[model samples]
Target: MSGFKTKKISKNPHQNPMQVSKIPSQKTGFSSKNTPENQKETSENILTSADKNKRRARKISGIFLIISVLVFGAIFAIKAVGNMQLSNNDEYKTFRQITDIFGDNSETPKTPEKRGSKNILIAGIGGRGHPGGELTDSLMLANMNYDTKTVTLLSIPRDLYVAYSSNSAGKINALYPMGQKQNEGVNLLAKKVSEITNQPIHHYLIIDFSGFKSIVDALGGVEVNVPKKIYDREYPNNNWGYEIFSLNAGLQTLDGKTALKFARSRHSTSDFDRSSRQQLLLKAIKDKALSLGILTNPAKISELIDSVRNNLSTDLTVGDLVDIGLAFKDMSNTNILMYSYNNECNGICMPGSYLYTPGRDDFGGAWVLLPENATRSRVSRYENMRQFASLVFEFPHLQNAEKSIRIVTNSKNLSQAKNIRKNLEQLGFPIDHQNAIVQTGATIETTNIHKYYDSAIGTGFDDNHILVEALKKIEPSISQSTGTGAKFATGTGQYIEIILGNDAKNYFQFKGISASMTENNNFSESNKK
Candidate 1:
């Protein structure tokens, strides 16, 4: 049987959007003279022309509609694929785990009760292909207070001796490696740090050396103001060899590699100084990243994620990071308080001198820093260290005030003046001992705290009232007065002068507030001479 066949017709003259269809005209066949038949033919031609115009319009509209649909479909598909890739990628998975993105409700990010402050333990380690790759090279506790809009970075020395196990003791840096034996390095380290600081550690971020370099490089570079020239004769290289590293003293931009060396070099300078430099680098990186708008730029963020994908580890989730960024969006360098422990003070111990190096014989021939007033049996009970941390975290405003303090006294009250300085220093007050003046005249009867600058004129002194109130709490007898006293000259900038009179002897003599034995012995010896 024969089947009926149907012919297909093309409605569109041109299949491409860019192509145009030509209209035919017959000038030779059509006559200009008016006639009944010619008029009918001309009218028919006009109708045909209008019909073609309508078809062209429809064709163009159809082409545009098709193009828009395809374009939108492709865009949505790309987005879907990107999301899938992120979900499947190892970096994204790690980030999710760190942030607890889809984890159980009970294991969510922790928020502290005290003023919504969050304490994060930041540790830097040398990753694989480097010597002692598992050990932490840098450790810092970053405390963020949303209420006060302040941040405190407390650097923990790697050589700090702490008990990692019930029967074993080692440097705090070793805790990371030891914890990794059971796959709980981050938690173990955070727990140990919490014990020392006496504050709960909310999260942890452990990035390797390579990750640090990649992050800095991704930010283009960081601008750091090197206070003094750095010349390291024994900067470690990748192949277990030492190389010379030096930087000029001034404002300079550092790349990733140079910044790593700048932060890691400790052979020429002490470890405490290195810790300070690390803090400086951190601030520089933060300033640069914020100024560049890394948070909002997708391309830059992608680059950063790629850079640290294999090298970074953290317990901070994407949400937590976003919250942190929003919280510190307007933070300045002044809002950050940087502190570390050291034994560099000459006479009496101060904030930076809260740690002292015990004999190497006590630590298996290893030089380690023990908290001042801490015995070997009670290394974890770093009372002085904890107190220092408390002062920084609690009275951040006082530390942020950065007021220079001068201790003025007569010969009869010199000992009391020194004692007050020690106490204030331990409490994290900025003391201006270099510019102090000592008068050997009659002892005044009343102690007064004098303010040299007008309280309303300065930028950071809005919180001066807090400082005054705290001092009153410490010593209720301390009278507050403004204007520079007669004995001490007005300093170049804003400062507080504590004029120690006979009544100053009773200041800071309360229980649990005793001066160091060194200060006591020095005062007694001077009195005899």
Candidate 2:
């Protein structure tokens, strides 16, 4: 049977009304567990109680502050000794203490070099306790342009099939663990990710499950908008037992465990949603830590540093982090751009879906997602990845224009219609929701564009300069329909009408099989015969 065969997995009747991005699986069973206590209580009560506690803590903090000042002075006086070595000096001792609490400190700080862009690959592992805990659960590439202060977060799916070496082929997440088994570790993983993205991974940060939870707790928890209620009945607990985990849809502050659940829960949802949740949780953690003055308060900073020490590893020194913090301190939430690859677009799976194709591993016969035909790129996955990296890093301006586009395809090829829409969406267009797509089965001979309700305006002109300019990048000679019609009235500044013709196969760089493909294959087979 073809790997694309439709399959259904049992769902709890009480599951939320929101649809999940369907991920096919065999032998799908609960792997870990969470307790009933992990269930999220209504956020309103939690927030009210938290506010009261904060107010109370503020009222009594002065007493502790006064005592600490006196004790610090007394200790300094007692420790004052001449002829103390630099290593034994109290100032040096405090510096070392700070360094230890944080990961590491740069020995000799240097002037910040003017690098046009910086790329950092951040990976999160499940950590020590849980089964397969050491494997990376999330991997993201952060591309920051220091001059513009704009950042792009590109999330690579964990199940992406990448061959780290000629002899080794596995999920991208396994690269780190497999490296560790060979005693090479994260460095090797970084190299592999860099190669895949076709961009240099200047630095890497690996956070384990403990570090993630601890840091969130240190910051008094993070608030995230759970868009839809999540009910993972068989959520994994630490004891190898399943527990029901449920969270209501709302804006709520999540403590360490709850935040982890919000980010890591994948029973009903697919990895795309999980990646998005992880990104949201990360922003929430940053916002909370900043709001709570952890970055400014020495004590809070020390506490957080100590909390994450064992669970975080990175070559980034304290100085490096401080430099980064100061550079992007003024960046607001809007300055950050996020993109992820998904299995489907507009309720239709694109030809040769981006999600990995499941199959048995050649080495062990264990189930794994494998690359059959081309995935991201028409020729190879590597080409596809590099194309994505270039678009992200080189054309950072794409994020600047938040274009809400509605695509209407007039093509007999349903797959081609879906494919074009998927490509446009992948280019970071905010498609006007899922139901916005209109498919007209009528086939034309050449692709034509109707721009802003005007057809005869010119061969290739549109009042929406941004849309026209972006389209020119793909097809320079793309022409307008050259006739005024009621259909042209449907065009908006954000919307474009595409009448796909047979020639569109060449225009969109069409690769996947359709009527044209079948004919080509038949001819080739007959030639072989």
Candidate 3:
């Protein structure tokens, strides 16, 4: 197939239209009592316009007032974070004071805030203590939707392969060091991430290991549930040596030091597992901060803010931070969704299933994960991540629906079945290997597609229709029919099962693209492929 042909899916007739109402602005200024009653009436008459301009003017004025209030509130919140009172209305004093508090360099300009959904890239570095301490230890993106009160955290693995300037390539973490050497490390890293994920990062927040530990300590530590026993015998010690880091399975409250270890440990497990632990730890930290009422405690808040000021560096202003803090105050654990691009779940091993592990002769045998498309087409990891980000930010409703459709092929052509599955998954559908529906009956059949539903959930005609429409986009000849046999209705929930036939072999063929990669710090496609 050349391309997945777009189809016109019927809309859900029962979908409700959400209505929003605007608040009418109140008149604040009072008329002078010294004015004559007739003069007041004359003034009111003159103010009134002949047409709808009066209402339009009021709306314009109301919008301006709201913007002014937001700016004022943001500034006030910034001062409050540091336990500083907004005593006088002198703008210059406030500006100078904020500049001093945040250590704003006169040479660096402020980061401009976007009007819509904001994407902030956060980087955690080792910072001045350890060898290559400038290397990023943790990298995550916070995508915040101001109107929806929703947040999605995406973690980018440090070991992923990325191309730098002048055709130099290395691990994703190296971007920071390379950029720092060039005198714009943070901005360069942000630019590279934006290129990789195709999502523009408006601002970046950088904090070293000390700041992370201090912030946790200031918040009195965080609580987490250990899913399994974790014992890392090779955990790094401060003295440039290795030590054991163990945690028993169960609920436990960890101090700053232990929490940092829990997040950074990666001896027994892979980087994928480490990414998961970091996300869980973040959730626990948020929970602990809320439970301790850190926002309400001025002393603790000031200390925490000081920790940030002393150790953290960012282009975002105090007011921007305040605006973010206030906007997402009500966002709880449930409102947060997390995603990571690992070897599994929309990622594939370059030459095999080991993620980014290199061949013996390549890159001095250094391990790296290469990003590939459904057809094994060489593509940038950022391009792949951009699609995932779109699903999180722009297509939440479809993503929720897409996760429900599970494809199971019964045909002998495994290659075609796998290709179809990959295409569907790239489109945001959740297709799991464990959930792959197997064919038990005799294999005499043509290609058939159908939806399976339960009485408890009733008929998912709308969702099923969407699945069928998407399938038709890929294979225009798909026949939508009921499960006339015993095989289709076995699944519990709503799912789409594709019984592949010999016709699939003719439709899908994988052209082996031999990836001729050289043995250097950077990897790229060769013309020989």
Model 3 lDDT per residue over 106-169, tens place = 2244344523566778778766555446667789887777656777777787766665532334
Residue 281 Cα positional deviation in candidate 2, in Å, after optimal superposition: 0.6
Pick by lDDT: 1 or 2, better one: 1
Candidate 2: C-alpha lDDT:
0.55
RMSD of 2: 14.1
Tens-digit lDDT track of model 2 for 1-529: 1111112322432211111122222110111112244557643335455457744653344233334434553223223211222110111111111111111122235446745766778888776666566667789988877867878787777766554432224456766655555445466567656555556666667787888899888888888989788999878777766788899999988999999888878886876778778888877876786677543454664466557655666655544554566577777877777766555433544322344554443323332343334431121244444445546565555645544444556646556767667765555544444644566655567777765444455433355455556655555677764233424225434345666667776666523212211111111112221
Model 2 pairs in collision: 32-236, 32-237, 33-235, 33-236, 33-237, 34-236, 34-237
lDDT accuracy of residue 3 in candidate 1: 16
Best by lDDT: 1
Q: Which parts of model 1 are misplaced by more than 4 Å?
A: 1-115, 165-167, 347-351, 397-413, 435-463, 469-506, 509-529
Residue-wise C-alpha lDDT for candidate 1, range 449-506, written one tens digit per residue: 7765444664322224666655665667767677533347453565566777777766
Instruction: Report the lDDT of model 1 for residue 491.
Output: 37
All candidates' lDDT scores? 0.63, 0.55, 0.55
Question: Which candidate, 1 or 3, has the higher TM-score?
Answer: 1
